[model samples]
Target chain A: MPKIVAFACEHSAYEAATAALERKTGTAVSGENPRFPIVEVEILKVPCTGRVEVIDILKALEGGAGIVVLLGCFEEACHYLTGNVRAKKRVGYVRRIIQDIGLEENRVQFFSLAPDMDARFSGIIEELSKQVVNMGPGPVTRIRDQTTKEQAQAAQAR
Target chain B: MIVAEQKPVAEILRMIEGYRKILVVGCGTCVTVCMAGGEKEAGILASLIRMAWAREGRLGPLIDVSETTVERQCEWEFLQEISEKVAASDAVLSMGCGAGVQAMARMFEGKVILPALNTKFIGMPERQGLWTELCAGCGDCVLDRTGGICPIARCSKSLLNGPCGGSQNGKCEVSKDIDCAWQLIFDRMKSLGRLEALGAMLPPKDWSKNRDGGPRKVVREDMLL
Candidate 1:
């Protein structure tokens, strides 16, 4: 099973995640709150999905999350009119960064939700979790170990 | 402005093949404003090339891909600033406009100067989010009659007489959505009471002054080197 770290903002996505857990829904939806599977996933609640930075997402990848998902409010529904759009742009920047660093772009994903869509949130999480399971461990974690070794050799050479 | 667009990544990669030591030079002027051959884009391209090289299990030559310490106007002193970095590398990839690339080629005679972007056209910002090429450098500008609109500049056919028979209701035949530049000029001139000026027969444009021969040269005694 892939270790999934999901960032749910303080707004609708968190509420939906909680609702999904209460409803025992195996899927991730947008607005409705549903139940979540307890064993394979860890959820981190943030102030706002827009608050999450590219560096933070990269740190999560380095920390062994096979897949990291950013859950935020819908595009035009953010409390801040363009916050979601900004978040999308940052996500795209980080995606390019990861790809440049030789990691698959699919390791990072973004989803939007409203306060009431628990079932949809749960469904999305379930589907993404399964996808992550099939994709296996992320490339960054594997590459870091080798990079560290190379750095050690370079240090010794000096 | 020196406008340019990024070359395809695959094409850039292929051009740098077999070169171990590579120097990526970025321009900080027009290419930067256009988001093509600027510092950030140069860094991205360098990183991507490094990653691609790593995939082949061959650590590249002492590749030092860095930006040129210059603006995008092709001045010689600015090109001189990157002389040390350029000398250290085996090949150079310039992320600049065509003028900048040509300047680098001229300054560093015999050195391989590869262009990382395709030079486009001179254009101005349409509004905040768009840019439209309005000038064609026809060697003659007639902004007097059309209220600053150059029919030669914006018209698809460069029609100086009247809108071709293809014009419909004031839009160009080439594109229905675009207002005919000639029509816009005529309307503006007519409103300005300059319509009678348009009735005067203008002679045929001198094509020899444009590009009939080889490259054109302009000499200014006041700015002589």
Candidate 2:
């Protein structure tokens, strides 16, 4: 199964994700609360989506995260105006970079959310998990192992 | 400054096909200003190469990629500063102008140097993010006679006595977007009260000083320390 990394904004997606967790077990989404875990879903909370950069996404993919998703606030709803827009642009750039490097573009995605939209946040995670399962493991790890094997075979041939 | 554009990634990959360990070097001067090749671009290219090679399922060999940037790639001092890096790597992928690439090749002797950018021309920015050619380095400048406008670079034909009957509505016949060089000269000369300059017949250009002179060089013994 593919590992998925989701960079969620504190003001929006983080809250929504916490709310979704609260729906499963009667608990408040707060610093004192221990959240519920969705299978293969790793949440990285950032102050804002704007804080997330192209390098961060690229590094995640290189580090064996099969899928990288950015969860930000909707439209003009960003507390820091244009934060989501900036994140969206960066996501597009990273998507293009990965695509150029022979990775599937769909491996990187951006979704906008509201603070209270628990259902939508859960739905996005479920959808991404399904997509990751379909995509299988990323190519980086496979390539590393393949190269080691080839080198061994070449040495034996000599 | 010289303006350049990066070559296609496929061509770059092809150029370094046999090389396993590579140094992807960037220039901080002309190529960077032109957005063709810079430190950031160097990192991107290196990452792309590694990613692409990895995706190929390690068909050939283990590709080891490293990156660095010099203040100017055309200068011997700057090139020498990264001599150790160059010596460590099997080949160099230079993210610099053609001249810079040649300079490194000359300094490094037998080291394989590959150019990542195609040097376009000597130009200046027309606006933010928009660059326009302003000179052709023809070795003979006539801007003094043409009211600071370059006929050699602007005119499609490079005619000494121009307008050539191809100018329409003050625009060059080649493209409506381009202003006729002669028309611009005439207007500027008239405005500057130097209309008589246009009447002066220009002599045949001396091509000896241009590229026709094989591998041009300048030597100033007096300036030698």
Which candidate has the highest DockQ of all? 2
The parts of candidate 2 lying over 4 Å away from their true place are A5-57, A69-100, A110-122, A145-158, B59-62, B169-171, B176-179, B183-196
Q: What is the lDDT of residue B7 in candidate 1?
A: 80
Clashing pairs in 2: none
Q: lDDT score, residue A89, model 1?
A: 78
Residue B209 of model 1 has an lDDT of 66
lDDT of 2: 0.82
Sliding window of 10 residues with minimal summed lDDT for model 1 chain B: B60-69
Candidate 2 displacement at residue B109 in angstroms = 1.8
Candidate 2 at residue B143, lDDT? 91
TM-scores for all predictions: 0.72, 0.79
